[model samples]
Target chain A: MIAAGLDPIAQFELHKIQELKLGPIDISFTNSSLMMVFTVALIGLWLLLSTRKAALVPGRAQSIAEMSYEFIADMIRSTAGKDGLRFFPFVFSLFIFILFANLLGMIPFFFTTTSHIIVTFTFAMMVIGLVVVYGVWKNGFGFLKLFWPAGVPAVLKILLVTPLEIISFLSRPISLSVRLWANMFAGHILLKLFAGFMIMMVSAFGVFKGGLAALIPFSLTLALTPLEFLVAFVQAYVFALLTCVYLSDALHPGHH
Target chain B: MTYLFDMFGYGFAAAASAAETVADYKGDQDGGAAFPPFDPTYFPSQIFWLLVTFFVLYFMLSRIFLPRIGSMIEERSNRIADDLDMASRLQLQAEQAQSSYEQELADARAKAHNIGATTRASVEAEIAKDVEAADVEADRQQAGADARIATIRNQALKNIDKVAADVAAEIVEKIGGFTPNTATVKTAVG
Candidate 1:
């Protein structure tokens, strides 16, 4: 059995694959691949179950489904406009998948797929790729004009403006990936660390003194559990929100 | 990097034994590593769902749902406006009718007042004429009554004087012892 207080970084490293091999280019499932499949199945089953009988007077499950639907729908509409209505399904799906994955990690002995940088970076790249493609599709070559604002002094544009735009553009994937991975990574580590503290105190002090010392960390862990849950939800929201903002830039390329 | 090597030591050991056990699982044998290397290339689950969800929502809203809702709202707004206009016209008509009725009432009241004043003046004039006629009739009747009473008193006094004269004649005859000569004549004349 894996010991408690094992290094958090070591846990991550254990999961990481150091090399790749070519095989029957057809169908072999790895851990990450399995996780991807599970996420898809989860999303499909969730929607299918939730919307089976979409009651006008929503039942508890239906209410949750509708709230989720509206949450992401309004999010897209607000950030991306009525035109962004087209993007709602994609954004909403993303929100649900991430939300479920984050929530799933809260269960004991479950893998948090989003805790890895590779998984997060891949999602970030997909979103960024979509934005670029959609922007170009919607606005044509005029999409390049997004990097250049009108009415700028000619000299200053080369020195200051171009680099800033490029950096800002490149920063999207970095920010997106890091935001999700870091939050999940830190949160899980914190929970593990606190739990370790609680155990250590209770064992070291014995039933009377140890139990009393254990209570402090126990209570603290309890407090942080809900906070971690909140963080999970928040990270999901941030991911979706940034996606919408990126999509908006694509949809309306000329706007700053 | 060192940490990665340390962490994977156990997994590698486990994989090597598992490889010997199962020849069917043959892909990892070619690589020095017993297991597959971590490929960051896989697209996360979020991408697939995001695409699916966006398309479904887009189709549902743009094609089937929003248009119906928008039309309903527009219809309701129009209905409310029509109702308000109807109410306003009805109110205006009611006000006009009320004013007309009030005006008619005022006119009737003025006419009634005029008629009452004229009737009162006519009645006063008639009363004054009747009183004057009554006073004249009373004066005529009193004058006639006074005339008849004065004639009756004069006749009574004459009759009384004639009777006293006759009595005096009889007394004279008896005392002188001579027969008294009598004549048939009205006492009043005598």
Candidate 2:
């Protein structure tokens, strides 16, 4: 059997550190939970320490903190309008959590919390849930106007457009979750796979010829690391951007 | 070519082994073999922990971190705006001061030019008046001197005629040894 270190899938394996059961449910703390807690602590401490001074002329750490704040604020303001600034806390939390989780996962042997479909799906579900709740709260029956777009003939609206809109609306959470999970999941796997290839080549052929052959996969792995970093950041950005877009619908439904 | 085929075969074999390991690992769990991500066994624990941590993060961020960071940003922007306002106001004040300084300089220059022109005109007028008075005094003194000289010359001419008449009467008396008539002598002298 190959060492677990060489197994790409082993990175995702969960081991219970503290086993707890509630009736029939197993709610044990796992590596994924540790990673989540670490992500939260890191975010909290960074923000807290950075703004401890809160000087008008920001220091380096303060500048970084402020830039992140403005980045998310501007994002919401532009996508969701001035009214959407209300969701600043919610969006900010999601962006920072995902961003830190993805970055921390890049470290060797660190569990990637966001790599799990369940975790990403939970965030996606929360986003869509907020949309539905806020939309109904704000617009009431008018929120249904999102499905019934303007300028469509009544026949086509009932037959084609409304159904399509509802289906697309339902698919929002699924797409949002999968897009993030797939990127992190595939990127890490690819990196591991190439690294595995290099090792396999060196072992299969003697170090002399095998190492020469391994160079190809080695270079490929080297190239993919930076690309994975980019993906990590981009996925976080896309998730937050889409969250804003969905929330914008809640803010103003039926107005494209 | 055979070596290349060998490499391909080994790559597939490695993949097959990795898949088998994954299956073995899954089989060790209580439920039937399933993908790790799709494994229902860990779902309840993941959801529970996810809820706990996410809410903790959300509260920490929304209640604490976000507000602190947001206010700092807002305050910094406000400070910048205030500084800009003050700078523009100071610039306006400086511009006003410079214009007023220029105005005062222009006024002083014009005043100096007016003083020079007036002084030149007054001095010229005084010089012209002095020259005219000197000319009139010289003319008056020459006229007075000419009248006195003419008077003195007329007195000397009258005395010379009287003296000539007296000398002729004395010579006649001495040679004739008789006194001539006084009226005749007078008429001769006249």
Candidate 3:
């Protein structure tokens, strides 16, 4: 077995810092939990401090806060229309939380909460749950029309199209959750692997020859670091965008 | 070509070995060693903490942060609109003041022109009346002078007849010793 130090997968390990029990269940606080708390606190403090003055002409930090607000607002507006602004807080929270979590994970030795499937899955399930509940509550039986698209032959609709639509609808949360989790997971692993290769070369070939050989993986790691950063931000954006699109479906499921 | 093939073979070997490591790790996982992410043991705690943090964030954002930013934006827009309205209104007032000033200037120019024309007309009329009055007075003075001259000539004529008669009488006494009457002399001289 590779030592835990060089193991690419080892970074994802959860270490319980505090142990707690709720009857039969172990609900101890772990590194993942700590990172999550840090993410939340960071977001809270950044926003609070940035908006403390709330000047007419925004300063640098305020501009970032306002820009993020407008970015999500524009996303929702473009996808889900003006009415979808009601879900602004929900969408904003999801976007910023994921964004901070992903970015914080990019730091050395930080646990990435979002790299876990369960975490992403939980958020995805919440989004889908909201969609279904809102769609049904607002449209009643008409929400099912999302499955029955317009303009198809009724025969094809019942046999093929409807079932496909239903399956697609059911798969939204899985696709959304898996997309984010897999991106973060794979990117982190790749980074670790390249870094491990650099170290491995140095150890295997001795300092002089190995260090020269390590430059190859080291350069790759350097290149991938920026790409991973891009992936982090893009994944967050895609998650929020998909949420808006799905919510738009809930808002006006009558449209194809 | 051989060197390239060797490099490719090395890459494949490395990848294959990495795969083996991953497979072994998976086998270990199956043997009750949990992979951190896929481990079911950590699910409950992560979910619980996630729920706690996410809701807290949602509450803070919805209740506090979002409204403050939204209101600031709304207030700025409103202030801008009000400022624009005030600026336009002030501009309108300025334009009105300029127009009224121009109007008053035009009215003042007309009044000044009227005063100048009336003064010129009245001065010219007074000058014409003074000239007419001076002409009439000069005419009357000339007629009076003519009448006085005629009377003085008539008196002189009468005096000359008497004097001539007296001279003739003297001459006749000195020569023929005869003198005509004064009345006859006066008729002859007239």
Candidate 4:
């Protein structure tokens, strides 16, 4: 994996389309913001048009839309239980947005919004924020029960286990956001680096000179494409699954 | 190293803010400006757009899209149930028709057998009467034949007796030159 010039990481950089400054904050729209809006618009158009008729026997477009809907629906049902369906809309939106963002990023020059730490962290924070708000509003004193199991010995619970449980509960957002961000960032870099490698190999030697050698990096990039697609899906699934799991904690505090 | 900050439990917000400062791969690609993803400046704009999109998508799905799909599935299942019910009803009707047809065929066969039995009894009675009349006619014919034979036999005996008597008388006259009574000759011959 020889990575030379053309800074593979530069693809992640943001430039202001229209800079807006208020006080010390620069809230200007960037390439990352544009991609997010695009993903949302795509989601809306697909869902609305596909479901305009909402045929019992779905056509291909409707089938796709329905499958996506049921996919997130089933995730919420299985992981968070049936009672967790109230959060279905939120989880579905999150999943579709991230999924589209990840997939759309695969295009030649499109930005991957989820690859940003701040963006992914914001989503993570929102999930955690919901958990905190709903967990407290619903459970009250019982919310603290999330860190205290029913079966652990009282002394162990106070001395050893509660602190560990608290740490785990708090770490959910960090690990969730970091995991997604790091995977996408690393994968995109590798793809670009390999693509750059192929170009370098072909340009360095003429078609007659490096024709055989260029195929190596070209094949590597080709091979990585499918794997990147897999990562795109798997990472989105993991993110949504964890979101539901956290919502389960909100719905039924200390049940796990 | 920042992952350590994550592990040591800096809470999500703190860790995220800290991640903003880390210089990521500024290898003179574009005059070595700060890598945009890690730089904290664009986060506000990114967050603003995310918030807006998330809200819009959530409302659209919850309010409109999900319920439509839900009804679609429900309609198919209902139609299937109705079809199955109709099929079973038709099956039941077919079974009833088959049973009634079998019952009617059995009744028709029983009536045919009754008619055949009565016809055979009447025919047998007529045959017995004809046989009795034939037997009476044959007996009368045999009796008449027996009576005629008896009368003829008596006549034949009388003729034989007369002839013998006449011959005896004539012989006596020739030999002794005396005629015997015809009656006495006849008695001796008989």
Maximum-TM-score candidate: 3
Candidate 2 lDDT over B17-110, as tens digits, reads: 5456457666655445567765678888888888899899999988888888877777878889999999999999999999999999999999
Native interface contacts retained, candidate 4? 0.63
lDDT of each residue in A193-228, candidate 3, tens digit only: 899998888888999999999999999999989977
Off by over 4 Å in 4: A1-5, A21-24, B1-32, B96-190
Q: TM-scores across all candidates?
A: 0.57, 0.77, 0.83, 0.73
User: Per-residue lDDT tens digits of candidate 4, residues A1-256?
Assistant: 2345556776888888888776787778788878888998898888888988867678999888777877988989988899898888889878888889999999989999988988899999999999999999999989989998888999999999999999998888888898788767767877887888767777789776677787887898999899778778777887888899899998888778
DockQ of 2: 0.27
Model 2 alpha-carbon miss at residue A72, Å: 2.4
- Fnat of candidate 2, please? 0.61
Clash number by candidate, in order: 7, 0, 1, 0
How high is the lDDT of residue A170 in model 2? 96
DockQ of predicted candidate 3? 0.30
Give the higher-lDDT candidate: 1 or 3: 3
Predicted complexes: DockQ each: 0.03, 0.27, 0.30, 0.26
Q: How far out, in Å, is residue A223 in model 1?
A: 1.6
Candidates 1 and 4, the one with greater lDDT? 4
lDDT digits (tens) for residues B60-146 of candidate 1: 444543343334435556778898999999999999999999999999999999999999999999999899899898889988988
